[model samples]
Target: MAAMKSTLSDAARQVAANALQNTLVDLLGLSLIGKQIHWNVVGSRFRSVHLQLDELVTEVREAADQVAERAATLGVPPDGCPATIASAIALPVPQADWVRDDEAIEIVTEALHIAATRLRKRIEATENSDPVTQDLLISVTAELEKQHWMFASGHAAHAQ
Candidate 1:
């Protein structure tokens, strides 16, 4: 896509770009984590969790692309290198090599919570300087919230 000239001041553009970059990193991290859980989850609920995680991964991938492309459109180079993403993302890595369905839900839900919180902050950061970016973040945040609800709902019946 062609880079578009932004009406916001350079400083504002820089701020928005920074938020976008962070969002991209978080999305990438979440996607990888989801895939990892999808592959390693083994239990009675294995098939269901695996399929749900795959869907989450796909959603995260699309969100990451949207965030990165927005940064590029603003003329800011998005840093999507694996090292950069690993270092920049705030979500914790899962400690266990293999996880049961309950554990996987906890891990994935925590990551989604973190991502959703950060995305909301990014949306706020971009609101005044760039409504378009803020809107994009809002959409992303909404989707993340829905995914979190879905994941949480799966374990709700078992919760004491």
Candidate 2:
């Protein structure tokens, strides 16, 4: 008879590491994009738009922290260094041309949508391996989806 191989599910660890790396990369892009817009925001809506953009940067930074900590908890080195993240992240190159609320929303929504999709895949990978990790991904993904939905809804309404 063939001997059965022993196995332990560490899929969660893999998911955590992947997510942490991706999050930091996206966060770096998010920070630059948000700050660029914040500094150059113009028009009569400056105050309101500035405040909202600041909140978004704050939220993305928080998510980065959570993902990094989770990676450490899983005994993996957190994958981030400013230069490396900048180079590795697959975000749109920071553009300083968009000066409208809808423009800002479009850029941010696209980036966050990418991040959210990545997280959803991570959630699936970890779901059967670890409920804790799956729950974490789901929670984070939900927040990203909320932002995406807001952006998408605005576009839809405007188009109609």
Candidate 3:
């Protein structure tokens, strides 16, 4: 059997792999939560929130693919299996069968906050080990932060 070799030193590859794997888990988990709320959301703001959820899911899914490919580029296999994500994901699971639009916004905002926070840490982790991977993480973090702000601001608008 042949093995993929990474150009990075062992330590650098390890660091990049850890950051990429964790980021993949978070991205996948966020997409799942976004879709859940997309389907279950109800209220005056349902249409807008549903559409926004699709946007969020699309962004995260693309980010996940990039992270996974980055990991493979580093010769580290990305584990995005349901079982792996189930065990590693840190995002809160939605408990309600039907969530109000306001509540959905709050939930999604909170999830994005968690994802962005972890992504910031991953960004820091990869900065010294791999600048190329670090750049990707930075871009992903920016998008997650944007989504977080939008959801949070939407909730505030509804509260007004």
Strongest candidate by TM-score: 3
What digit string (tens of lDDT, one per residue) describes model 3 on residues 1-160? 1157888899999999999999999999999999999999999988999999999999999999999999998889899999999899899878759998888998899899999999999899889899999999999999999999899988888789
Enumerate residue pairs that collide in model 3.
none
Taken over the whole model, the C-alpha lDDT of each candidate is 0.89, 0.69, 0.92
Residue 98 Cα positional deviation in candidate 2, in Å, after optimal superposition: 6.1
Better of 2 and 3 by lDDT: 3
Model 3 error, position 66 (Å): 0.5
lDDT of 1 by residue, 7-91 (tens): 7789889889889998999999999899888989988899999999999999999999999998988888888998998778789
Pairs of residues at least 3 apart in sequence or in different chains that clash in candidate 2: none
Tell me the spans in candidate 2 whose CA falls farther than 4 Å from its real position.
1-12, 154-160
The CA root-mean-square deviation of candidate 1, after full C-alpha superposition on the true structure, stands at 2.0
TM-score of every prediction relative to native: 0.94, 0.78, 0.96
lDDT minimum window of 10 residues, candidate 3: 1-10
Model 1 alpha-carbon drift over 4 Å, by segment: 1-5
The Cα error of candidate 2 at residue 46, in Å, is 2.7
